[model samples]
Target: MKAWALLGAPKNQWPSNIKAKLLAAKKSKDLIIGVDRGALLLEELGLTADLAVGDFDSLQKDELERIESKVSDIRYSLPEKDLTDSELIMRCAFCDYQVSHLAILGATGGRLDHFMSNLLMVLKPEFNPFAEKIELIDQQNSIKFYNAGKHTIYQIPDYNYFGVVTLTAVQHLNIAGAKYSLADFNGDYPISFSSNEFLSEKKPLELSLKKGTVAVIQSKDIDRFQNI
Candidate 1:
């Protein structure tokens, strides 16, 4: 499967520790697309992008010129829009790039509303089906939402902590191979049932769902994402 990552509004929001992971993904992926301010992060990281997207609203003139010169596609969006820059770029990737899996960075830490909106974006009908594949990753936690199905989650080495949360209403949930265990679980609003630590370094946690979609998050150190 192919992987792609988009960086958005990185500025002071970039996590120093996650830079290595970003670099590794860039080398392992088919393409890296930067959205608006994310282009700046790509440049700052000294990584060239295969594609760039945005109105160039958040970037300076020289930066914009530099990016446009390197990438084959520099798709632009209107400054005024119902969609955020990240959402716009994601739409582009789903259409043109046809990437099977996507991870987004520079998406958290800036604004509470923005962060939650981004997290909750996966709840959209158009986006939910891709949740099992589309992930939001940072230095600390890698989060994604999945619909009613069984999923085998592997270790990132960096993210050894695993948790499953009910985004909507879910029942008959089964969780195994963690510090805390659950069986035939039922969850409601504001209730996150399965938050467990990965005790077995050699094995991964297995999540089996019988009903609704869940928010799965894996973290090495949750605190790493604290300041954003």
Candidate 2:
């Protein structure tokens, strides 16, 4: 799949391991974009961005100029808008560029509202076609959305735990190859199964659903000493 990576404005710095993964993706010809202050972060990390987007609200004039100097394509939005900067970039990537997959970094560490909005954006009706292709990555978690279908989830060696949560009403859901297995289960609002581990390192986790959308998360447990 042709992948695109977007850098969003987050409160904390990205960890080195995640940065390395993004660097590899960039090297493999993934279109990279920086959203507002994220452009500065990309510059600092020595990464090349195809474009820098969003209103220069969070940055000073000089900072925006620096980004402009580094990135050739710059897109500006009105200060007041219905869509967030990240959402605007998403629209551009999916609609304009028509990329098959997207990996979003620096999305989780900002304001609670913004983080939640970023996470829920994939659930939007307009984004349904790209739902399975979008992923939100942070230091501790990699979040992916899926529609009603059978899914095979591979174990991430870096992450110890996995979670599956229903974003909407789910019917005839089955899960296997996990420490706790579920079959033909139905979930209503706010239903989540957390802290599940893979049954085998080589075998993948299997999930099937007849209806509704869900988020699959591979995460490192902060409470655990080994990962922390």
TM-score of candidate 2 on Cα atoms, chains taken together = 0.90
Tens digit of per-residue lDDT, candidate 1, span 1-228: 355555564445445565676688777865687777777677777777777877887777887888888878887888787776666666777766788877777777677787877777777776677677778766567787778878777767756677778887788888887788889988766356544787666777788878778888876665655767
Tell me which residue pairs clash in candidate 2. Answer: none
CA RMSD of all predictions: 3.1, 2.4
What lDDT does each candidate get? 0.73, 0.79
Q: Per-residue lDDT tens digits of candidate 2, residues 101-212?
A: 8888787766788778887877778776778988887777889988899999998786878899888889998989899999998877858799998876688999999988
Query: What would you estimate as the lDDT of candidate 1?
Result: 0.73
Q: After superposition, how far is residue 142 of candidate 2 from its true place, in Å?
A: 0.9
Candidate 2, after superposition: displacement of residue 116 in Å? Answer: 0.4
Query: Residue 194 error for model 1, in Å?
Result: 6.4
